[model samples]
Target chain A: MKFPFTSEQLTKLHARIETPALIVWQPNLEKNIADMQALANRFDAALRPHTKTHKSPLFAQWQLNAGAKGITVAKLSEAEVMAAHGIDDIFIANQITQVQKLKRLRKLHERIHLTVGLDNPRQIDLLRPFFKDASTPLNVRIEIDSGLKRCGVTVGNDLVELAKAVARQPFLRLDGIFTHAGHVYAARSAAQVEAIGKQEGALMAGAKTLLQKNGLRIATVSVGSTPTVPFSVRNPAVNEVRPGNYVFYDAMQIALHAAAPEQVSLFVLSTVVAHPVAGRLVIDAGSKALHTDGAGVTGHFGLPVNIKGKVVRLSEEHGVLELPEESTLRLGDPVLLVPNHACAVANLFDVYYLINEALQIKTVPVEARGKSQ
Target chain B: MKFPFTSEQLTKLHARIETPALIVWQPNLEKNIADMQALANRFDAALRPHTKTHKSPLFAQWQLNAGAKGITVAKLSEAEVMAAHGIDDIFIANQITQVQKLKRLRKLHERIHLTVGLDNPRQIDLLRPFFKDASTPLNVRIEIDSGLKRCGVTVGNDLVELAKAVARQPFLRLDGIFTHAGHVYAARSAAQVEAIGKQEGALMAGAKTLLQKNGLRIATVSVGSTPTVPFSVRNPAVNEVRPGNYVFYDAMQIALHAAAPEQVSLFVLSTVVAHPVAGRLVIDAGSKALHTDGAGVTGHFGLPVNIKGKVVRLSEEHGVLELPEESTLRLGDPVLLVPNHACAVANLFDVYYLINEALQIKTVPVEARGKSQ
Candidate 1:
């Protein structure tokens, strides 16, 4: 991973740039994209990476430039924002059920190579009318439950029936089968994560094979999960991999052994606001600035890299750090924290302070910050 | 607690309205405001309600109009936003340490009744230079540690020294003393909360007496915490009470018995996007919409009051609900969730859907949504 700005750049802008800012180290971010793409290329899988973690069309373009074929979004609102920013090949990883949302999706479907995750044929029935009069047929990917147990049809007859129903619809094209190995996050080791990834790939590839045997054309088999991406991409039958969190690996990734301390690209820059009592120092970064994804396995909400401390708890605007018995970090000292979950931390801020090697400062809006709908 | 929209209102816009939207039923909001104001009046305390919870200037105005003497904010950013909306009586309930922030605070102090919390004499030493030549002397409140070991000086020599230093400064008007009884959130019983509230009032009152005996005339004795407000306001010594979360009583409040079910005025509106499993269904709302405050006591991350299910887990954009064995909730069904923590949930959204008794729908931007800096 690329290091942050040099001492020269830090001199010019470090003190002036506001505290509680989302500092996106440009070099590390670019390195993260390059590393993930390299891994995907080595496995011969098309990197259709998830954009929900970054939620930036600018970053999405960088990923595309690095050989990503398409981008995946979790919400229609996210799809709307990314596509409007000239992101062409998009896949919404969640099902849209509202008629109004379906209408919005139809308008978007006419503009890009859009495929939506659908598990229920009833939803296909709803989409039938909207897509029947469309210029471009909406690609429908049946989301099969590999292990996450969140969304998606279970892998047996239910999966086959959903695909058949989509194939029967003239407007709804059966484009692919997809599965998310999100449960890999709970795995105790990289070996455990690999096992989950293999299951995820098998689930998607096997579903595709099952559909093709039933005389249905299945064009793609996609699987993704940041922790499982390394193994999932290696599956020859898996054509597309969509891991979003690889762009800014966080404390959780480090705990899962998916990344090293040097690989964490994002850090929330905060200042020690108050040294209230013994064993704890309050910082400006709180639940609003950082992610409360809980203290993973380390029992530290975040690693305050600049200070020898662990954020033990947070209020709205205060991070209570449990420091070493005699640590000398004082009030107003600039501190940096690598949050437990980078995506949630990114969503909390409106803009990011992009710091490059030469110390050039760039401010960019978190384009899809609240596009959760 | 006001009932959310009538059947007619939900019918008219239920399908058209997007998921993960903050639904502010104005009737309940108005009722909640009036009730809090009444409670404050019953105790003859100034309802200087903290505006950090619902960081909306519009809601702050409502609180002021309903007899709130002033408003409290946790950050300079929050005060800036509230002041821009013509909110005059603003007390920043946190310390300002940075020279830039102090300069900005000085500028803001010129235009409003701004008081800030400070605990350290070193901070006063820093402030002395900035406020040496001021138009209106800055009101300074020495934040004292009541029970929560967060910010604030301890109750003895440290607290006395800070207050005396403030009183001695020519340009720093020693406003009073403030203590946040935030630890009442850990109370499992009303008696425990009441015990914490009594201690909060005693600590502030006792500190004021000790300071006055030392020739420091204390004007305001303030205590604020949502969980302790019910009892804290009843203490005659606490002249100013600043409970921020009363405007939207959440699941935690209901569990604490600080609020009734009918008093919860705010909720998140979401729709069931998929019913892909046997016992669980997914809503379009996720960690971004609801809070990750964890289960208070009920073990329910969120209470979907409008639906017969509990939100068991959340992904970035999906709330997986555990439905009863034979539930009738279907795909495309509208659901309302009362988040465990209201402040965190409110900060996540950009806008709120205001539905009043008249069924007239109005959209207002969550002005302080990303003003966390």
Candidate 2:
């Protein structure tokens, strides 16, 4: 388990670097990436992993290098950052409504293979002009709400109408139908996660059949989420799967049985900066590094694990570790905090740590740490 | 009001600048700084503004330039950044415990007039060696918990004990008693906010009396939050006040009656990127930008404002807008959304909108947006 950078280097770097700095582990990251890539290979589906998780240009390169079909971005800025980093194939997984962002999208389309996810017929009309002007028509994917009732066209006739509407646009090419089983993250076990995944894939595949019968060309059937992927591959209709958080699973992922403890790739490395009371020791990391979130409960936001200690409360900049014994913890020790959700935690910092299993520092950047605008 | 940069220049700069860019509004920022300065001056207290709000050297310069006696930071990195910017006076308002951080604190003490807050007696031991090494001993303030029962020495006698402990340390100076009425943000009205402020001031003053009776010299008595200042200034015992969010008040600040609408200096300038339904238009800003926390509500996170049009709901990266039926929001119109909690929103992005009253784009770089790390 020899790491790229020695422990002495990390200690030295720690001295030079400021406290509350983000420290991402490199070995865990590569392992997580390999695991997801293997799952994609097993499914025989295109691995268009979403880039919104890390948001670092360096992480995007890793995903591309890992044999992903393309990148999926939630915003135009994210896509633009990836594009600037020379990532050409991108899918704006959410709808594009803003004219200013649409202009950016059209500009992006001029040079890259840009596709957008659409949930409504009006959205199709909105993108029609850009489709007509492009040298090649922009690819459109109707996002079906399989079970997660957040965004997307509800399964059934509504989805059919949206797909047929896509066919009506002469310049718009209907690439496929996509669905995200976001609800699968709440699954209690692998069995429940698989069930949700199958349902999600079936719904998207069903939408594709309806569209094909309605004289619309369906090229891809996409469905995914970290929790749903294992079960989803069983459905042959799903051509591609997109799972973002699998690369850096968090406390929620573990609680939902999506990933094991060893599979988690990210942790907020913090130091115990203050011992204000007999039982309480405050760490350097706070809401800013760990974003305000806790899994399975309210009030307990970030998951503070005792690397060798236990954290009880988190203030804006200090994490309070409450212990049973007064002398259990020392003043200058570094602590590892597994955040409730990794995606939001990744969004909190400009950079991340790339340490190994032996806690050795490696290549620091994970590519897409702040790809969001 | 005139801005430093024209809209066209801003647009061009935004287009040409690096991807993952952070844009800030200079004029709006100046207004925020000036307003806070006037309030601090009106109260006749030494304004030691919290630098944690905007952890940029440039903004720290603005506060110092506007007549702040000192800049307050929550971590060593923030203090280091401020020190590099030539900010000599700094107060690490949170407790410092880790030996590594104490080592850095000793180094920081050499260049700047540094003071740190401590609540428990255990912290005294951690600071003892660091202060002994520095030519000038480290100034330690006893933080009293004035209703925000998160961190601090809550009891009066405990404060005295901590002060006595500080006095006993060869390297520690017993500065005074300080507390933040963080619960003031939960207050519903101006009167309630003022009452919390006065209560906080009285509690600190009470702790000061306890320390004074113990034969310890308490030089500074401080208590404040953005909500309590106007109310707490009436208490003559308080000598210094540190309030961070006053510079860029948010919708929550407004809802708490802490600030007027015009006094709010920062807003998330996003675009209406998608229109899925006639009433439902989505903006580019989502949970990552506006934050997931609303003022006591679950789904309601940020302020839904009329930009060029209207916004209703905000998802992760998509803000759903409920516009008038007769009107149509095109693909690319930019909208200014005033976030619910400016402090949390500031933590999300790397930059902000430095704007004029007419909503024209100006020089944008609230550089310390992610200085929390």
Among all candidates shown, the one with the greatest DockQ:
1
Residues B2-56 of candidate 1: C-alpha lDDT, one tens digit per residue: 4566545664767757887888888889988998899889998899988878888
lDDT of prediction 1? 0.84
Tell me each candidate's RMSD, in Å, in order: 1.8, 4.6
Alpha-carbon deviation at B121 in model 1, angstroms = 1.3
DockQ of each: 0.74, 0.38
Whole-model Cα lDDT per candidate?
0.84, 0.70
lDDT by residue (tens digit), candidate 1, A1-373? 3335443454355477777888888888999999999998988889988888878889999999999999999999999999999998899988988778889999998888999999887787778778898866789888888888899888788888878888887787888888887888788887897788777877777777788888889888898888888877777788889999999988889888888989888888887788887778888888888867746555777887755768988888888888888467667666678888888888899888888877677888899988998
* Model 1 stretches with alpha carbons more than 4 Å out: A1-13, A296-298, B1-3, B6-8, B294-298
Q: List the residue pairs that clash in candidate 1.
A: B1-B262, B1-B263
TM-score of 1: 0.97
Q: What value does the interface RMSD of model 1 take? A: 1.2
Cα displacement (Å) at residue A97, model 1: 0.5
Worst 10 residues of 2 chain B by lDDT: B14-23
lDDT of 2 by residue, A58-101 (tens): 77778889888998888777888788889999998987764445
List of chain A TM-scores, every candidate: 0.96, 0.90
